[model samples]
Target: MTEAPAPATPAQGGEGLGDKGLSGKSLADHLREIEFDPRMIGMVAALAVIWLGFDGLSGGAFLTPRNLWNLLVQSASISVMACGMVLVIVTRNIDLSVGSMLGFVSMVVGLIQVRLLPELWGFEHPATWIVSLVAAVALGGVIGLLQGALIAWLAIPSFIVTLGGLLVWRGAAWWVTQGQTIAPMDSRFRPLGGGIEGAIGTSASWAIGWAICATIAVGSVVARRRRRRFGFSLRPLWADVAIAALGCGAVVATVMVANAYALPAGIARRLTEARGQVWPEGGLVIGHGLAVPVLLALAVGVAITFLATRLRFGRYVFAIGGNPEAAQLSGVNTRKVVMLVYGLMGALVGISACIATARLNAATNSAGALDELYVIAAAVIGGTSLAGGVGTIAGAMLGALVMQSLQSGMVLIGVDTPLQNIVVGLVLVIAVWLDGLYRKRLG
Candidate 1:
């Protein structure tokens, strides 16, 4: 038949069909077609609702710059740990000891800085914070390594091993100085916890924001070029541009909000006096830009994202999580990767401990108490599957923010602590149930 009319070439028929299909799709279907994560969109929408609801309930106080800034700061330590938790959970492991590990590491850091280092380096020595930080991180890594070894090499279940570690580390924390609280951390170390003094100024924040925007734009171009070179599928040019624009817009908005929060007049005056500068007649409006702890948390998130997405180790971790037998048969060093993942988790806890201790200017056995619950809840809420091989650094960080927002919002509205715990428990259960449903749908 006239050679079947050349089968109505795909360009002639397929294009129209595709156009019709797209025209009939909903916004969500379009987003899915673009390969965007729907869970992320849901989380963002939920966060927005939470913020607006809390703001209304609190008479507009919750959305104020000061409260928002403090919320970011409060989320920092948990976010840092959640990044590590993503890796741990990805490989089908759990670390219940993170909170205890944090407590112990912080206690040791406090002891080193306040009691031991002062005897050797003297108080406020520049090296005190550095030495303490290094020691704490090392200790954390060692603890993690030991726990990982027991799980990987000895064939012990991770839950049992980490459970033991939880008790052991908590007791060790209490034994360190016999449950005494240490206070007034070194002057230099205090900035890590994030106070007015711990923030970068408005100019610096703007500079950083613009720099990040430039990086996002450049990265998008480079990625597109790479894909082209490989002859791989690519997103539409508009999609790429939109993604970069959204990222840059977020950075710009964050910087703007940070810069909008002016310091109290009394604090500004005292700060100026300390700097040997005269106070302005009407008082100065100094913006406490990005907080140090928040910056550190963001940096950690970036580094972990790169590690998980770009490195062979990260690939191995996911492979193991997806199918341990297959990964092992494929020549992956499953044991070593598992052990290393734990060690990395411990190191992150050390960083978190430093932030927490610095923020409170003290370390107590109770420091990081119940933190494990928060960390796990955050990772889970962020879309990390407890079953394995499903998580993202950015998602976990966002999850941490969501958890913090819930707690903060409740506290702002004067909810009782018990009620707060009940709310968090319910949220955790709901997140797990939702995750199960999402996974089932995907399957």
Candidate 2:
């Protein structure tokens, strides 16, 4: 028999190519070989630019510790929802009802705390707070389950289903409140939103920040050792160290600024009075500690990141998004995956409702109006592809930060509300366009 052509050796091929030609380089070879994603690097650079640009425009007011802390708090609600939203979009689906769901859940939980659970059951205690939270999650999940069932089992389009849900839930919320506001909720409930007394002490904040840094450093070392055990190629040890250092530095900076702002007005006055010193003339005085809402958002983001990057369900989500037919052929139950994704989305909506309501200290029918657009925009801006199968929880949260920063910076710099919307809409369009171009280049 005639002999087949000799295969190309590693020495004869390029850095990542192999004997079998271009197809021999797996997707992991192309992507995981890099120390970090270029997209992420670019996004970080953009954030820096925005920070500086706004700081300059606002005459140094934009980067104030107080402003940054407020920014983190304001962005927390959207960031929490964006974590779940990333999975939905990754699976090539969208939930238009998140904003409405937030409103509805807020009203339901508000009623439970303010009227229903208290007067009906004659139960008003710390336990009632737990009950209200349970009700919020349950209500959100049931709504999501209903919508998911219709879409996944009955083959209803997600857009159509969620679009209908959007209107239905908003109207339901209005009905629950009878077109009135529910306000002055429980004092214990106020901590969830991080009001004056709800924030942690400065010492606690710094301790948490350092603890995060330590955890990241340990995780990196453990991960690197595991990869070595498997004989997988690793970037230089210095690269890993550098990344860890940068992360720690960021944590330190954020915590310090928060500490600078942490000396609250009332607390500061107490300190000044005790020391018998008058407060500095026209000096900056800001709030103390990190907001509870920010901490909650961070927790959600970390949990979702672990799920999306380390779990089987997370992998299936990406598979479904990348190519549903192929994933199905490979034995993935796409319907179940889709349904679970939406259900998870519902739970996230509940968390967001709690935060939003706590922030406003009231439950109103319009509590979540137009928030859907903001959530989607945050995901898109964070580098989640609308084309599906590509996104990260961290990226989506970063996107939320960027969106909020822009809004806050513009407001500080005197941009009109109408103009702010116009600018944000433009940013969304540009982000999608950039994503398309990046994908095209990869292809």
Candidate 3:
């Protein structure tokens, strides 16, 4: 009898082998198949290139502690809102009203500090920062809940509702202030705009440097453990370690550079001599250092990351985003989830508004004028899919930074305001288009 034909080995495994042909592939080969998209890689690389170009043109000042700090602070509000926006977008929904909502909340916060608190409770300490923050955040949550109900319970399309809200809220903001601007914030609230930590001078920088390192280390460890526990695939340990190390190095380097700034050198020394009499003296130093916005962004990022990765709500969010019907079928409270997402978005916008108010030291009826565009653009640029079900807080933050950096750089380089606006609009369109293209490629 003819012997049974030799069983095919992996190399001769029919179609599977045909796919590989003469190419040898190890386990790493399988990993490569599921690697990050090329477009994503290219986008990130492009950002690096732009940053480098700007750095060169600005003679390294562009990347200075002061500038970097400013960039961070400027991006913070957007980044925070983007976190919630990602959740909303992941659910295959959009909220066009966030900018207006944010404006309204900022105005409310200012109004509370100026008129409401004093009127409502007969207390005029002039230090209503904490109270204003609480009221603003609450206002955001309430708005979110209402919108969520309209969308989830009433089945109203998010686009229409939020768009209407955009108009309504902005109108309300203007009405609240009677078209007057609110300014002259409390001294207690000033630091949120741009404050320092540490003993000022060199020690302050070291303190901040260590803080960043610690944060990165803790975050990396927590993330790695969570991914492992959840049975999610992860980058190699080496990769993780490298990222953490690199982040720490970057922070330290940035702080050192910021401390070298003329502003920091003099101010830090003064702050140091004062012996903790003041807040730390470093935030976003041009060419180096941290910015309040950056710190705020980092804080928001960490919070959202934990919420997304470490909580059941986050898992449901991803689930809903990926397949709402399936998620609902699986007994997930789809309505509650939707409401929660809107609420969270509202809260984020509110927080962002507070930051914006602090930054500007005023609540303009235009506090968040047309900000929805930038928020959406940043999220898309940072790899958040418009189709939903995929996004990262880190990506959103980075995207905002990229956008803000481009704007700031253009201004510094003397590109006219109109040209800057045109370029930014184009960038937003390109980013969204690229995201769509990337999704199609993935599909």
Candidate 4:
């Protein structure tokens, strides 16, 4: 009798052993088509490299719990602004005036909080903060609206409009402040920036971290269920589990680091003295958990992501960026969409200004100088396309973190200021160049 021939494997055109057949395409093709977001993966790897590089140079000080916590806090403003900038870029528009807008709005906030409210009422007005917050955000939006209108209705290029606003707003800020600094910001506002006196404590940190993880898991489950109801392809169960597990791990790691550096020496001593207790030889009190500004950034990121991914407006943005004529033909109201994008950006600018001013506990004429460059770099480095129709809030957040980490690491490594700027500028250029090459490949 002739020996039985063995069945061919997947490579030989037969399905692989125990193939599920759920994937309609051939195994190889299915593997190739599997969804994977490279931007975030690359960002995480880049961040890891930065941490390792800086740790080595700083003798491990760079990754210390305190330093890492401080890093997150410091990056919060840039991160918040980047969230809004993502939408702007996705619509194929750029706002060079964000830095100037921030400075100008911050001065307005300062005038209300430090001078106008107090001087008018002789004592801090009870409702000053409430009114100031509204006014700041609204004023920023109006500025953006005017600039966007010029671009949309008058046929002015966005670059030109925002560039003009950049000069105009900065000059306005300088004139308002007269080159002076405004200080003694509101008590309630300080905590929003995660100042030393107003950060979350240890318990709250862990709670917030775990809560975030839980919320993400729930959101994932809901999304999966909705997709299934619509008969969309669902990822394997293992993938969902793995993703949730990774998110939990990340949150736990962040909380652990913050806990490790709970209290600094001076703060510990003050606590001990206040409690009338003898301080231990080298022990420090646990100061606090995650900073408030980090939480603010997280909240803003969540809101922006929802707006971008779940709304018709966001869909219109991508459509317009991809093909303005087609989008207009589809009744997308291209001009209004672009205008709303810039308007939203202005509001975010106001928010970022508030955060930065609170952190410094002062608003200076130069508070946001060069910040527009940093914000744009964050969005680009986070994987936003300059040509539009591509970006994510998550990517922008990670990009802001990367930029801040580089700056902080450089400071620790004692790199010269000029050299640092040169390095950052090169990174931005390289990022844009790589993106261009990527688009060319697709073409």
Candidate 5:
């Protein structure tokens, strides 16, 4: 029988191609690819430019250390929630209940501090602070577990379940507080969320935070190499090194900038008089440190990144997102995965509530109000796809920072809160639309 034309060789594969005479692939194709959503990157870049432009117009005061640290603390709650939201969204689901859950947790914790802790079933202990925290977190976890089970095992739509949770949790929160505010937590607890570590000029805690970020960055690079080796994939060493170094540099810059503001006026004068003599007994110190919350958030971020990037569970998460059917065929327990993701999100919200409560020094009935929108916006704006399957902790953090900066900067610039809300809402719509457009292009 007459044979068809012979198959083309790799060299001959490009013969019919125009100009470059190159194949479809290149050396870069074998490297670890860029993982961020394009829409996210664009939004982040735009927000960053706006932040810097505004700071410049404001005579550089907006970029001070105090302001930066404030920004980090404010962003932390949303960023943590966004990380978990990323997982939920990747599974093609949304958790509208997070805000109510947060509020519930906040109210529960506040009550523990104010009422529950003091009345311990009959007897009271002066050491109720620890008990209160544990109980608050446990309750949060339990709620999440129940909701996750309902969504995963019961096969109820996440929308309905979480919507129910939103209403239920809000009522529970109001019930717990009787529509009143709880305040004046223990001094010890305050420091955990609001206390500074180090002298006025140098926050040792912020330094530690940067150190943790560096460690995480290094660990990520090594883990990436190991993954490539195991997958039998080829990657250029230089690229990994470059990426790792860039990450470290960014962390250092953030920490440094957040601590680089002028020492408070009192500290400055003391340092001037001391002329660098032993900090002049509380003179403006170079090492006056940062708030404890900043460090706590950094530590949390590092741990989450490690879990998401370097673990088998994390791999399953991405696989399930990429294609649930394929992942199921490959032996992944899709139901369990979904349950675990929601549970994890619940735990994160619990922790976020603790931090927010501590920072506010009270859990008002309005705690976590409207926070869900901001948290979700941060994730989507940072590049988490609402349709599921792709996201990063770093991207979520960046997104949170961008959102917080915009809000804070707007207020600093005399923009009304109503206008700010309108702006953020518009940005959210634009981001989602852009994401949809990119998906269409890819399809």
Candidate 6:
């Protein structure tokens, strides 16, 4: 009877079972074959749920154009720092002092602009903003270098070095202005913090969106061609097309949302008057396309993503993280890479400081208090494993958005400060737990 049994049909798991057809593979199988990161899918789904839940609880206020626009601006600084944190975590290092570093650098920049530069260049001098920014960034890099040196050259642990830095820098920040706040920053510099004047126009936003879409499409095609030329395994053409479509669609949707958020009537009227145009019977509806800080964050994300994915330095960092002894034996300059990663993290923190100071129009010793937690949480939530050698800049950026979204949503629902902290702490713990499970499954 066994010898006489019929051969297994395709439906019963024969060769054609793996074929790409309705009769063979299910949708889930097709998705699996496309090699999409399941974690990313889960994150996106979770974000959708959060948004929907918040919008419902907030009586539809959470998803409005104005709220969304403000949310993006608020998220800008955290997103910027998270980009660098991805690298720091990727190399098995931590920077507890970033928040304090941000405060110190911001205080210094504020002093230079508000109290020092005006004395020399006169009020609102064009060069004041540039000089202040450069100095702030340089100072941040120097601080990072010092801390990294202590860790790398002295063979001290990063946790100890940065923990000391956290205290030292916070005290330094207070000392910069003797616990006073610096205010009324340079006029040109204020836009970096993203008020009504900080936005690029609707036309420019659309142009940028289109350019990004074109790049995605072209890049996908080039990647596919390169894979074919090198005889590497290729994703299905349909998968590539689907990915490109989704990316372009997202860009377009974002641009549209930004363009939909209109300027305040008074601001629009004043702008028209300043331009020597008569105010129409109906107020002009000028859109706040995209904030400068948001654009800066985006640029950082793109640049960091490229650096991490396409550079020798990045490879060395990851190699060191994967196995430090092996990487050192293989001739990787592990110390140099580690030092450089921290330096880069410091530079990013500097940028975040500027954005925060500009937004508030003031800098205080507490400007970035607790921000290190947010940055680290964003990186962790975005899939930067604490075990190191596994992370993505895009994921980190998305994670920053998720973190900001939660806080913003909580605020809208009138959640207390302590509760917010508790929630954030819980989220960070859960993210790490999930990451451990993911790693274990892979192992």
Q: Cα deviation of 19 in candidate 6 (Å)?
A: 20
Top of the candidates by TM-score: 1
Best-first order by TM-score: 1, 6, 2, 4, 3, 5
In angstroms, how far off is 107's CA in candidate 6? 0.4
Tens digits of per-residue lDDT for model 2, 393-440 = 988999999999999999999999999999989988987888778767
For 213-287, candidate 4 gives per-residue lDDT tens digits of 889799889978997898877776777777788888998898888777767678868877898998888776675
> Which of the two, 2 or 5, has more TM-score?
2
RMSD of 4: 6.2
Quantify all predictions' global Cα lDDT against the true fold: 0.90, 0.84, 0.77, 0.84, 0.74, 0.87
Model 4: runs farther than 4 Å from truth?
A: 1-34, 120-126, 265-284, 438-443
TM-score of each: 0.93, 0.89, 0.82, 0.88, 0.82, 0.92
Name the runs in model 1 displaced over 4 angstroms: 1-29, 274-276
In candidate 5, stretches whose alpha carbon ends up further than 4 angstroms from where it belongs are 1-44, 119-129, 195-203, 206-210, 213-237, 261-283, 286-288, 438-443
Give one digit per residue, the lDDT tens place, for model 1 in 40-103: 9888888999899999999998998888899999999999999999999999999999999999
Greater TM-score among 1 and 2 belongs to 1
How badly does each model clash, as a count of residue pairs? Answer: 0, 1, 26, 2, 12, 0
User: Candidate 2: how large is its RMSD?
Assistant: 5.2
lDDT of 6 by residue, 201-243 (tens): 7989998999999999999999989988988778778888998
lDDT of 5 by residue, 1-443 (tens): 01222334424455544322334533222321433244544665777797787698777868777677777778878888888888788877888898999999989888877776666553335466566667766777788888988998999999999999989998888998698999877555665465342223355646565675678577777777787778744334565666677667766776677566556666566666677554445445453355566666666676777778889888888888899899999999988988888888888888888878888888876788878888888888777887788877777777788888888888778789899999888877986787678657544
TM-score of 5: 0.82
Cα distance off (Å), candidate 3, residue 164: 0.4
lDDT of 2 at 356: 86
Please estimate how well model 5 matches the true structure, expressed as its whole-model Cα lDDT: 0.74
